[model samples]
Target: MTDTLTTLRAQLLASVAVIDEALKAVPPEAVQLDLPKPAAFFDRLRGRLWPRMSVSQVQGCERILAACGHAGFGLAWTAYVLATAYHESGYRMQPIKELGGDAYLSKYDTGRLAERLGNTPEADGDGVLYAGRGDVMITGLDNYVRATVELRRLGIIGEDVDLAKTPERVLEPAISAAILIYGMRDGWFTGRGLDDLLPRTGSATVGQFTKARPIVNSMDKAAPIAGYAIDFQAALFAGGWA
Candidate 1:
């Protein structure tokens, strides 16, 4: 067990090194290719949900953005993603279970949540097992299955790691980042992609930004999330990333 833990730690360090190298390689002309310093990021998040963003969490966000850029996400997509994370995790930079997660599990054990998430009536513990998790709050059996399949296909998670079975794995920073990025970009979370609201041109009016609420939740915190997106965009612009 100790050996396994050691190996995992070594692998994590190697992954961090790789991300650092990649960030270094980013060309100056790339749109908003830089990450905010940890101090700056935390200061911006002060009095917000996650004022104490950890060094590791900031690194995770940076690595995720770097990977997204490599995958063709530009300034707009990056800002939108940051906003989504801000809303979902309150800038915590980690996968967090939904507020009232226990209540949600109990309430949805065999009700609407179960049905919507593809949990059969006989799947007694499905709701509790697959309740909302991850940076983007992947909820339900169907979404978990989709996340597992897509992450596997993208080579983000290993074949040995069954995210559907081990939903907690969604909290792993790299894995969660991949899930958030791919899910939002490809509409895996819902049938609505960022492009549906923001457009490929990376421009979004107020109405269109608000429309992105459906991409994560059903307009629950649409206005606030959109406002967060606006703040993120302005920060990106100030940093010459947008």
Candidate 2:
């Protein structure tokens, strides 16, 4: 493996170890009530989709999970998302589920859709159209428009990008993880951070622990078998498991 890939793999392995250790100290019964059976959810989705969906659909999501390091809650998150993706629109092969395919999907009026939404900058040659497409769950024109500008500022994307054109950017796991982590740190998440997210009624009703339980349980199940599981949980504790 390349040095960069090796380094990232090591980091991912370390993170998984942290999560594994933290879970061991906490009793499964204590967290059992919060856990959901993602497998059951998966089965229901498969039945509904019927002949249209296939195992390949599930495999596609697992590929993403593996790319991002299948550790702790991340693995469970992958299952949840994969199930959703299969049930939602069948892996985005359909135009309706595609963020940029449907003309109506641009209600947010940012990035690429701004011009169509009657924004004056439609005539501006220096607009970058943003389509929050693909696995990172990018959404709305505004996000892409802003991200394009940000990328330009960082010298990663050019300033004169066409807003009318679909935005293109890398989506590898490490890049995606970097974007997600740095984005959260930059106050990009819906709720500030874990601390801010935890106290809100929306969050409390759902419960942070509740959302995390399935993955935690899955991680616990996988810990003994996963070579790096022990160290992953330890890192999380060090990082405060937030």
Candidate 3:
């Protein structure tokens, strides 16, 4: 038994080392991009989308983009992340329930939605509580628990904070950004990473944007999200970031 435990420990350490080496291989340029000011970003995206975002929310959005870029995401990936946030948060730059928020809560309080979301029949109210949060709308009990564990592992959230129990914490910009980038890149949210959606084959393309819907939410609102990605790409180019 002791030997078996030792072998498992060695394997875990080796896995960690492999991840560290992979992170080191990311080029500095890949993780760095010129970010636009909040006002500039707002001006460029206003009327077209994010009509409800305040200047502070715009700043939060810029911060999320810069954080993703600095974490080794390229332009296309960053734009997709932005577009996902735009749709998930209703262009507010904060976590929010889907349209018909209360209705979603009430309906999903039980029934098929609850079951599909991994809310056991005994775990009453789980559906409404863990509906969706964060930039990518981390939904369901399983995802909330996973997010809490992963964020704790990344030191982005305290060990004592159970995101499953307190879904509101997912609304914080820094926390949401960390969860968004990590979840999307690592396939924790949808079992589909950015690479699964948009391959890193040189430059960005319109096709990639159109195809990124399944990476986040299914086909729902995919067209608008794709349009937002295109808009973001154009904005990035104009800002000299792309």
Candidate 4:
């Protein structure tokens, strides 16, 4: 179901409270991860999960970390968002265009996908126009419009910006970072928020990472993404994310 502004606002406030409590629940000295081996951790992540992982990827994660703090998300929440970007962007850790041409993307223009995406059934190229761009690959007209609304509500964007008009703006690093966190945190892309995935806010176990997959899409790559999330959790800890 499409979320009304009021409904979204309510979810926003509730998620805020949950995040606040979740952040507070962490012990001040809790560094559950191993020693702060920043270099080795990076080596492992880069060598295995992302062979070409670069400084840009780390910087991108740092940006998301900053947004997580701005949104009061704890390590678990932030790590999941990072891992999602890892999977969605194909380890680029940067905004990338969704693959596929008009014929393929057009499937989103009419039928169940169109209804879900809140696009018209005219097959007028909404899919091609609104193809996913950003850390998390959110697609379609309604998703873009909702991103505008949520970003504005989060104070990440302003009145001057309309994502539906300048959809490429979502590709900007800051906007992409904000979209990843906000969409997953408040369930903009899907009605299932982080609260739905974790048994407790900010305390998702590794297995639960699989469930969080629904925040963006179905369990298309849940296992691999979950592994990525676990690795990210460790790497972020190594990078002093706690």
Highest-scoring model, lDDT:
4
- Per-model TM-score on C-alpha atoms: 0.75, 0.36, 0.76, 0.78
What is the alpha-carbon lDDT for the whole of candidate 4?
0.78
**Model 1 lDDT, full chain set:** 0.73
Q: Candidate 2 lDDT, tens digit per residue, 1-242?
A: 69999999999999999999998975343233221443543354444434344555554433433332322234223233333232223343121224343345434344545554333443342222343443434444545555455455645446565332454442433333333323332334242432332231221222333342232122222322121222222222232322
Ranking by lDDT: 4, 3, 1, 2
Q: Tens-digit lDDT track for model 1 on 138-221?
A: 888888889989988987677898888788888876678788888998889768887777765555655667888887777888
Q: Which residue runs of candidate 2 sit more than 4 Å off their true CA positions?
A: 1-56, 70-128, 140-142, 145-166, 170-189, 192-242
Instruction: Report how far residue 184 has shifted in candidate 4, in Å.
Output: 0.7
lDDT of 4 at 6: 80
Please give the RMSD to the true structure for each candidate, in Å.
8.2, 15.3, 14.1, 15.1
Give the per-residue Cα lDDT of candidate 1 at 155. 77
Best by TM-score: 4
Clashing pairs in 4: none
* Candidate 1 TM-score to native: 0.75
The ten-residue window of minimal lDDT in model 3 covers 29-38
lDDT, candidate 3, 167-189, per-residue tens:
88877667788888888887886
Instruction: For candidate 3, list the clashing residue pairs, or say none.
Output: none
Angstrom error of the Cα, residue 34, model 2: value is 23
lDDT of 1 at 158: 74
